[model samples]
Target: MGLEEEIQELEDEIADTPYNKSTEAHIGRLKSKLAEKKEKLEQQQSGSGGGGGYGVEKHGDATVALVGFPSVGKSTLLNALTNAESETGSYEFTTLDVYPGMLKHKGANIQILDVPGLIEGAAGGRGGGKEVLSVVRTADLIVFMVSVFEIDQYDRLREELYKNKIRLDTEPPRVNIRKKAKDGLTVNSSVDLDLDEETVKSVLREHGYVNADVTIGEQVDLDRLIDGVMDNREYVPSIVAVNKADLIEPDYLPTVESELEERDIDPEEAIFISAEEEKGLDGLTERIWDELGLIRIYMDKPGRGVDYEEPLILREGDTVDDACRKLGGSFDERFRFARVTGPSAKHDEQQVGRDHELADEDVLRIVARK
Candidate 1:
């Protein structure tokens, strides 16, 4: 049978099969088969070379994508956060195209993208889903904007992203698989594994692994094992913003926050704001900056004072050599050493080498060869 037919058959088999401790292995194998078919189908469909999706080149220090159901004020948020003129409306799907904006915060430039609103079946290519969902996979951060009244829609948006293999606020399963020529399946786990060896072997076999070495770093159940074996996934960090807070009463805002907390939303991730009213924007900006983990490097010239107005923006853990490369010249080849005067240095004007790791607000002066 074809991939679709095979997928449907496997789905039907999995649905009809009894789900229990005894039938777990059978169900797992069937699910693995289904996942493989679905992946293959997606590849085949996307491999057609037809390009009609919204493609935004990543710019600035980092790129953050605004994702939510329609009429969640993503356009308004983009305008408030950046200099982009994203059209806003009271209707759904107002953002027909990807709108790019730049948010300048703490001497760092952050690119904010207002994408088409997502709906149910988005990952399945519904309601311009393929184009919209494709942009989020490349985001450094996903701002899940939902209306204060429709706070529950955040779960639905997250679920759709999950179905598309975009894992938000989650880490990849700690399982590794190494294929071999003839060595039979050997499963080893550093921690207690709940999935039986036979089940693991069956799932691997369904994924076309007849012989392999499986290593599990942590305790994982059958679903985790399958996820590891499937292996085509993206782990992204996401934050949920409750927009249009001005529409709600002040006293009722606490109740809304309480409901969000009960749903296990992190206080840092879940914030109340009204983009139109420009309320709580500073907190939102700070939260985005912190979540992105950016570091600023101050550059100084010889006999000139440091320009703290626009510092060199770099990702956390970036080194001096990386900062030099950002200058867009042959400075990397002409590099000798640098003077450091920040938390990373011993004292004022300490001479450091090229490999010195830089810290935030560190003043640097690169000395080139004569």
Candidate 2:
């Protein structure tokens, strides 16, 4: 039988089987097997030269992939946010290539990519989905665009990305494994876990772990455990942007908000905008800035005042060392100490070393060795 057929059979069995303590291990094995088959199939397709993958060169401070179903205002949103003139229409699949656009906000150049709208079976290489998803995997953040009236498309779009091995808005499972020549499998967990040791062993064995040491730091479900075992998944942060807000009346706002609530998305958290009319776009840009976690650091160059006009941009949690690296050349290697006067510093002009963490709008002066 073909690998796809085998995958289908496994999926059918897993779905048809009843779940309980008695069958938990059995289900785990089935899931592990299913994941392996899917991986193999994907590898096979890639080796056969499936379709063309969009050549998306990451630009600016960070790259954001705008994704959703066709004709869901993704192109419109891209045009509204950046200078890219993505062809927009009232029909599906208007964007056949990955359109690149730059969104400059708060002294940072953020690249926004308008990818082709995803379909139901896109993850399975349908309609050249593997190529599109490949580009998305390279992005730092995902901007999910959906029509205000078709908020349900959010779930479908997310599912397609999930099936393509993209884990949105979630961190990777903290499951560490060490392979051993012998002595059988050993499982250790720091916290109480739902899946017992035997079930964990069963899943690991299915993934070809004959003798290994497994350490799990958190209580993980079956899917997470499988994710931990596999290394092909991409974990990305995503935000929902409901487009076509201008078309909806104020009275109908509550209805749309309720639909967002049904999808477990906080209505207040989701950005409602009219990409066509360019309404609520400021809020959307703010969301992108916040999500990207980009921070601005004003450099205090010698004989030069703080360059606040053209401040250096970095990600959150960046340290003095990272700032120096961004500065490039001799700044990192010849740096002796840095003085910071901002939110990250304890006091104004506090002298710090390379390990000092920087905050947004921090005035930084680096003193290097002569």
Candidate 3:
């Protein structure tokens, strides 16, 4: 049985154990520790190397994963982004094994994994499902793939996550646009035209929000109007690639563009691409890296007579205070200040307190009097 199952079994046995007043208090503490350990085990099992074969491979420093449904250009995109020489085919299940590739971006090496395809009933071992599902559960971020041709694809993806009880905290992808006039504007990729109250009302009518006074600067109650239209999943900050854009006619592009705008989806966030043809792949790669929000920092060795490198190596979080706390009470008590260099530091001097947030590519020199 898995560690999780074993933990659950132990919990059941412990609950049934005869407990006096004194033993009851100790039982609670033991249960809490058991719960914490179980959570950590689950986290490890989800990632490759933690327990499953889905551990994050270290490239230079950064880690990334390419995730999506089968035949959604996931492997193709991975090959393009990393040049990993992974086998790519048109057929389903071409990539049975997970493939790891190194992608260099912004002077940082990012390890990208092309995970196996997922289908319906995956969580329950349908089509060798549990394997791929477990692999994805470990990913820091998922590159959710969808074809532009599939109507209501976004909604379907959400339903699948719901079925598995996988809660995703994705921030809604949106763009801020300032309107010159109070009247609503019809947003297009190339041109922005005035969409008066009448046009807004008409669009609302089509969505069944009839007789609704749709006006600019007025709060449009999203729930009262449309059901299951807006994606409630916390936006994972993604760049939308409208794949197979070339398949549709030129004239239809405007209509698709307008529809996306009506939904408040940013046109800039949407990239027109043909993954098969490698068209617009460069732009897509740039967008993905930008949205990932990663920074790489290099550490330098401290000079002799005042060596602090040993204790600083234990630091994990991107902050001076975090580094101090990791050194235990000795460093914390003797902690005078921290001399931070690189991006986050304001000056080339010792920083005052612990609240200073460290940035990527920062070289820090912590100060403590003996």
Candidate with maximal lDDT? 2
Q: lDDT of each structure? A: 0.85, 0.91, 0.55
TM-score of each: 0.91, 0.97, 0.54
Judged by TM-score, which candidate is best?
2
List ranges where model 3 is wrong by over 4 Å. 1-62, 170-239, 246-249, 258-264, 298-317, 321-337, 350-355, 360-363, 366-370
lDDT over C-alpha atoms for residue 264 of model 1 = 87
- RMSD (Å) per prediction: 2.4, 1.3, 18.0
Error of 2 at 155 (Å): 1.3
- After superposing candidate 2 on the true structure, give the runs of residues whose Cα lies further than 4 Å from its correct spot: 50-53
When 2 and 3 are scored with TM-score, the better candidate is 2
lDDT of 1 by residue, 234-318 (tens): 7889888889989988788777877788778865568788999999899889889989989888899767889899999987888
Over 229-336, each residue of candidate 2 has an lDDT whose tens digit, in order, gives 996789999999998888888999999989999999999999988888899999999999999999999999999888988889999999999999999989877888
Clashing pairs in 1: none
Tell me the number of clashing residue pairs for each predicted model. 0, 0, 11
Error of 3 at 211 (Å): 49
Model 1 poorest ten-residue lDDT run: 46-55
**Candidate 1 vs. true structure, TM-score:** 0.91
**Residue 198 in model 2: lDDT:** 91
lDDT, candidate 1, at 194? 74
Tens digit of per-residue lDDT, candidate 3, span 275-294: 77888878876765665655
TM-score of 3: 0.54
